[model samples]
Target chain A: MSHGLASRAGRISAQIGIVVAIFLFWEVAVQTGMANARVLPPPSLVLPRAVAMLGDPVVLYNLWITSAQVLLAFVLVAPIGIAIGLLLGESDYFGRAFKPFFFFLASVPKSVFLPVFILAFGIGFTQKVAFGMFQAIFVLVISAIAAAESVSSDFLKTARAYGASRRQLYLDIYLPAMLPVIVEGLRLGMIFNITGVLFAEMYVSRAGLGHLVSTWGMSFQMVNLFAGILLAAALSIAVNEALRWYENKVGAWRG
Target chain B: MSMRTAGGNDDRSGWILLLKNPLVLRLACLGMILAFWEIAPRMGWVSPVMLAPLSATVISGVTDFGVFARNLGVTFGSLALALLIALGGGGAVGLLLGSVRPLRTTLLPIMSSIYAVPLVVVYPVFTAWAGIGVESKVLFGGLYGFFPMLLATAAGVRTVDGGYMVAARSMGATRFQMIRHIMLPAALPSIMSGVRIGSAMTAIGVVVAEMMAATAGIGFLITQNRTMFNTAEVYFGVFLVVVLAGTIDWAVSVIERRAGSSYPRKVRTL
Candidate 1:
């Protein structure tokens, strides 16, 4: 057990060591004029700005806007997507007939539709949210269908033989069977949601973290740009890790 | 006695069978969507300006074929170059990491963490570095495609059966020969899936880069037309992109299937 813990610790240190080495290399490169500081600011400059930006109201507001759009899109799409998925999954004919279309849509790069959303909904909060919904719905639906369909037909048949009511079948069997996968779908959906919102905001937005990063980049404010990019990355990782944690919690019963 | 039905009954049942065909069902489903696309705008259910009719979009596509074809050539060129870079670099790195357990253990977590970061936010920085040209787009798209290929290839390599390696070694097979004949075939499905995803991402990155800031390409065409309120042309550009992406995805899957059948195991690859 101690040996296992030591190896894990060694692995983590190696990961951190690599990251630190990269940053240190960057810092030294910039100082020595080997790398252009204006285009690629060192972490020493970026890290402080990143920390300070957390207390900056403007930065905070942009973060909030992006987060709100993602949340709104997720909230609106999840129930409807799950319901459609369940129906399609439960019906073999409909599932086969419709799944191809769903897969095709999902495979398409949804960012290309940003302009269409802007045209239809205007370049405002609604447009960003709509784009997020567009990106997220397909992922959620596809995953939810997979989750629902994963429930064995034999289990359902056995339940029916035991005179289980429809309510009992759903409550006792389907929900428990599908919950972990559903949570996993939600996690993926949230990631897509973040990407969609960020893409839309970056493409053309008056306010948002994406816009802040873009603006900083355009003006050659490398420090601020680096900081903003780092901040966005941190937020995304936080959300992803949180969802992953929840996914593990829900899926623990499987083991 | 034969159990064959009468001619009239056979004809009716044949027709029913045709309707029941999976291909027919899929086509019918898509046909319905196309029908709605054509009818909705024409029937005033949706404004033509917001959603162009299918006919109008087709007409627009035909009329603007020169513009689209020229831009498409540019986008396709960049996509090809970006995909080449991504697959080459990612495959090499993945191979190294996968074969070396210590390296894989250290790096896989960091790779996933990086993947979680929506890499689009860094595009502007890429533009600043490479300029708003095909170079920037290629770089951005290459970066986008890199991760999936890396992760997938690594996973594929790691999952390779040890028995094959042991047998090859006992037979005095060289390291290079074993990897070439055994590992490559076994890992082909995963690598091909990586190609599939990588191509999609590369296309998206190139298009998004064009859309964000570019003078040419399919995405730029859509954005330019949208600003001018030429809704049909915008729809046409979008259709072209969807078609391009779909074709690439379909082609990769075909390649994957054909190559994967050589090894003949149901590897549930990503």
Candidate 2:
């Protein structure tokens, strides 16, 4: 390997070493009574319980629900958000009027919207789906609008000079231009999808991974709670990393 | 073209322009929404429980303004305090780690991964450790702000241009001089994005924690009304939160723009 590759390998190993050291310290602290076991359970205790719980029926069922919510939300948000984004990009008048509202909507406490959603959709699975969809939609819409706007005007002018039809201009030029940004929006939407679904579940739903985590928390089951949290984190990290990897592979065109 | 006056009063085009003004269009849209909100419940087309009529909501919001204002002040004050600490502390830590190569390689990945952990789930942890008070809410808000702020600051410092550094060094500049004259100026825009992001999240953290644990504050008020099925008051609380969030975002952006105006804009690349 070249010096660059070797240096990268060294850095990765050093990171792994630090993480292992921290876990070792944590286990020692709890086992030796240096830390309170009830409040801060060691990784050794938590890890086994976490692995066992992964096979539990309740854990599996709730995990399915959370994943389903995210999937459904992506299905809904991408089409509707992009359609509105296209409208905003094409019409300067509507864009001026609506973009600020969407901008403001983006910043607002989505938690406030949760109660409204729960009330409207009922305190059930649909409510969480609705919340998650809203959470992801604006991310898509805003990014889509910016992406569409950013298509080079010079390209449009050049196509027009060649007597290209409007349909041809959009299909051959703007659509391809918007692809990379839409992928980025897809990544953000997925992250927000998990977060929103989890938020709604944590607050009200009696089922799902979020509720399981909360149940553990309230019962003072520190080991179990940490395990559940770590499990959820692992899922999030998996999705985040997967999307990032895919983006890298497809986004070489961006070079 | 042959029939119309050239420059004098032409009410026809004036009406057309008035019709097309975005402000007018926006108001028209709001008016349509208000109209539907008022008519739907009374017409029995939609349940009032789901959406309280505009008039009833206005009355409830006005009558409850005192309560709302007090809660708003509490929530806003906690967020402001949390933001102050996060900006100062996170920025310092980010600068420190960002300046060191060994530390950055080891810790940056850990921090970024931790950032994706759904922090809202951990509200109960904060509640348990800190107890349900303004302090717990502030701490949670601080946590939210710190991660984004630090990441931005660190990335900003790390990405400072090598050419700029070389030019400064060739002029016999000291380390402090290089940082002040070159590093900070280049990093300002990225740091500004972090501040804006952190500021936006501050409201979310405070209000979510308050909703989960507090006895008072806007989130608590909404929950209280929600339990009673008082849709108007619930709507009122939600509106206030939206306003608070919007004000924070607008203020932060305005500040960022002012701070960054003198700097040359950096074109983002994929």
Candidate 3:
């Protein structure tokens, strides 16, 4: 047990070591004039700026709004995706009929629809939510369909032989079998939704992290822009890790 | 036996059986959608301008094909450059990491952290540095595509079955030979999937990079039209991107399927 713990510590130390080395190199390069500070600000400058921005209520509010948009979109699309996927998986006709359309929708560069969305819903949260939903739904549906199809035929047959009804077979055999795949789909959906929200904000928003990034970028406030970017990156990582943890917890049930 | 054969023929007539075949049903569904779209505008249920009919969109696409082609060429060029860099750099790093357990453990999280960062935010930095040109797009695409390929390659290498290495060693194979014959073939499927994903990432990178800064490419077209309120042209630009992305995705899928099928089935379960 101690040996295992030591190895874990050693692994973490190595990771930290790498990060330190990178920072040290950056600092040295900037200080020694080997690298231009204008192009790449040292961590010292960037980190302070990030901390200062954290105190701003507007930035926090924008972050909250963006997060809300992503979550709402996920909630809106996930159920429909699961339903459509199950329907398609259960019936080849349904799958065949809708699959191509889904593929086309998925293939479309969603950023292009910003104009239409703006036209229909105006430059409001509704439009952003719609874009996010559109971005996430296709991936979820596709993944769910694939997952549903992956359900073992033998398992379904056994359930049937035990006098299971259609509903019972679906509930007992299909749902459990497809849970992992559904979670995976959800992961992809979340990622796409996050990306969509950022893209939408960049394209048409009065305020958001993305807006802040662009605003600072145009002004050439390199330090503040880098700070905003770092914060956004941190938030993305946090959300992803949270989702990963949730997936693992849910996945444990399959055992 | 004759009665059983007759029963089988009757069973095959079920609607459920027909619906179970995706290819036929999917095509029919697409036809139905197109028919609906074509009819809806004519029936005045939807405005022609709001949702341009397929014919109009196609006509506009062809008429503007020269501009689209030039934009597509730039986008594809950047995508190709990105892929080359990603495959070359990612494969080399992944191989090194895979062979060195400590490095893999140390770098994997950092790599994922980089991947988790919304790349759009960083695009401005690249644009600011590289200016509004193809160089920025290539860099963006390379950055976006690299991590997936690296992770996939590393995972592929690590998962090379021990038995294969043992067999190769027993035959007096050198370390390089073992890697080439045993590890590479074992890792091919995963790496191919990575390449497929990387292709999409590269396309996305090009689009985002262009959006951030570019005078050409579909992204530039969309941005230009959007600002000008030329919704139709905006749609046209988007449609072109969609078509290009779809074509590339289809190509990748074909390659993956072919490569996957040709590889020994024994490697699959691994």
Clashes of each: 0, 0, 3
Which stretches in model 1 have alpha-carbon errors above 4 Å? A1-3, A154-172, B1-32, B170-172, B261-270
Off by over 4 Å in 2: A1-4, A153-175, B1-23, B167-181, B257-270
The DockQ scores of all candidates, in the order shown, are 0.63, 0.60, 0.49
The DockQ-derived docking category for candidate 2 is medium
Which lDDT tens digits does candidate 3 get at residues A86-155? Answer: 7877776566567767766776666556666765566778888898888888889888888878889998
Q: Chain A TM-score for model 1, please? A: 0.91
Better structure of 2 and 3 per TM-score: 2
Candidates 2 and 3, the one with greater DockQ: 2
TM-scores, all models, native as reference: 0.90, 0.88, 0.85
Candidates in order: C-alpha RMSD to true structure: 4.1, 4.3, 4.7
Best-to-worst TM-score order: 1, 2, 3
The 10 consecutive residues of candidate 2 chain A with the worst lDDT sum are A245-254
TM-score of the first chain alone, every candidate: 0.91, 0.89, 0.87
Strongest candidate by lDDT: 1
Q: Per-residue lDDT tens digits of candidate 1, residues A95-164?
A: 7668878877888878888888977898899999888888889888888898887787888999999999
Give lDDT tens digits, candidate 2, residues A1-255. Answer: 245988888888998998899999999999999988878889988899889988999899999998898888889888999888878877887897788877766666677788788668888888888899898888888888888887888888999999999899978778777877777788888888898899888888889988888787777777778888878888888888888777766566657
The sequence of per-residue lDDT tens digits that candidate 1 reaches over residues B1-270 is: 143233333546664675555556778768988999999999999887788999999999998899999999999999999988788888888777776788888888788778888998999888889888899999999999898889888888888888887888999999899879877888887888888888888899899999988888888888899999898998889889989998988888888778777775864342
